[model samples]
Target: MDKNAPKIAIVGAGVVGLTVADILQKDLNKANITVIADKFKEDTTSSVAAGIFCPGSSFRGATLEIAHRWIEDSWYYWQDILKTPEASTAGIMELSSYVFSKEDYGVTRNSFIENLVPIYRSVQGEELKICGPDWKYGSYFTTVKIGCDRYLPWVEKRFIAKGGKIVNGKIDSFTDTSLRQYDLVFNCTGLGAKYLCNDSNIFPMRGQVIRVKAPWLKTAFFGDYDTYIIPGLDGVATLGGVRQYDTYNLKVCKHDAAAILDQCSQMLPDLKKVEIVAHKVGLRPHRVPVRVEPELIGGLKVVHCYGHGGNGVMSAPGTALNAVKIGYDFLKTNVKNKI
Candidate 1:
């Protein structure tokens, strides 16, 4: 290790943190990187996400232009990886999805990804009946899904190979740490940010899903009430979910599970017969505008990059890239003066 190189610490192990670590190692190769997080792999919310690339218009930043830029940058970032040979191993796969709405036309419209994806078009008269009767409006689009089951491990492996260190520990506070020790600290602690920064704006949106062995199903489907059927690379499809606001209940709710089964069965009746693989519950760290800014905390150069809400996996890379730039600036200015 070069003693003159900057030392950086990333405080979360979810997709956001890992993605930041990945790019940082590449962008600043001489810097010493350490990932300190309490949870990793399946334990983080990044693993629980269905990992779809589509983003709702509601997912935003401080401004509309910044929000649009994040989505566009993220789309092209994943598209570049999708073309690589490691796509499958990295859990990046191209998937076509159908969104249907019986009453609200707005449910079928996605302004954020309409023009970004390769194919986005309204369904025809006969195609409306493809799922079942009572389908009024629908849209068929081609997109990509990132299965975190493989992605998290893949990224971690690459990070370690690039001389990055992984430290398993829950960060109690930012100011409590040795501020002058590291050049910069990145706060990417998803739901953990609630306590770390005492950020009242951050809240948990509980979601539950059932994974089933359904190889026959290829395309993804999204109906009302956050209900979705997303197929992964390993022939396992993720059927989900319910968005319970301000709910911290990680237990599998029987009522929510029953409703998911009923709604999903209505879309693909054959799903009722598929064997269940597993059930998962996650608390999405949601905020009004996903936070991505630099703050000086007790003389520590800290860049905040949490509050990804439900679209963490979808937009992790873009946000990570932005965080890296902020961190680099902090190191060059504030931390350099202290050191």
Candidate 2:
């Protein structure tokens, strides 16, 4: 390690934090980086997600342009990964998905990626019947899914190989003395930001999903009530789910499981015969506008990049890419001020 390398600290180990570390390791070769978090790998909420590329209509940054860029940049980022041999090893895969809603045609349409993805169009009347005879409104799109169960470990391997350090500890405050020596910090704490930043605007949007062994399921299917069935690696299909706003309970609710199974089975009758793999729950850190900005915290330079809610896996790369650029600029300014 260079004796004078910039000492950088990232205070979360989830997808957002690790992606920041991954980008920093590549962007700033001489930086000594450390990832500090209470949780790691599969223990994180990121693991609970089926990790599809679809973003909620409400997902946004400080501005519409920035929000669109995050999704656009992320799509291309995954596209690059999808072309490489590491795609499978990294748990990234392509998916052809259908989103349908009996009550609203708007639910089937996504303005964000209509022009970006390979396909995004209204589904045919025959296609609506693909899920069930009662389905009315639908749209078909080609997308991507990232399995954090494999992705988190894969990225960690790459990060550690590049000389980055990982530490397991909970951070309750940005003013922690241990962070004094670091030249800058990146707050990718996700839901923890609600407490660390003491920002009431950040709230949890709880989600629950089920994993089933259905080798026959190749494409993904989505319905109203946030119900979705996304296919992943290893013949595992993620069936979900409910979005309970302001709820923090993480335990698997039996009621949720029964409802999810019923909804998913209705979409694909064959799923009723699939073996149950697991049930997972996560609290998405939701905010009106996703926070990704610079802050002066206790005389330390920090870049805040959390509150992605349900879209963390889909948008991590894009926002992390932006965070690195902003952090690099912060480092340059810090150097100039010291000199």
Which residue pairs clash within candidate 2?
Answer: none
User: If scored against the real structure, what TM-score would every candidate get?
Assistant: 0.97, 0.97
**Model 2: lDDT to the true structure:** 0.90
What do the candidate models score in CA lDDT, each in turn? 0.89, 0.90
For model 1, the superposed segments whose C-alpha errors exceed 4 Å read 178-180, 335-339
lDDT of 1 by residue, 1-339 (tens): 677888889999999999999889988788799999899999999999999988875798888777778888888888888999989988999999999989878889888889889899998699998889899999999999999999999999999998999988877778664445777899999989999999999999999999999999899999877889999988999999899999999999889888998899999999999999999999999987999999887778889999989889988988888888888777778333332
Per residue, candidate 2 scores C-alpha lDDT tens digits across 25-97 of 9877877999999999888999998999988899998898999999998889888888999999999999999
Point out where model 2 deviates above 4 Å: 334-339
For all candidates, what are the clash counts? 0, 0
* Model 2 TM-score, 2 decimals: 0.97
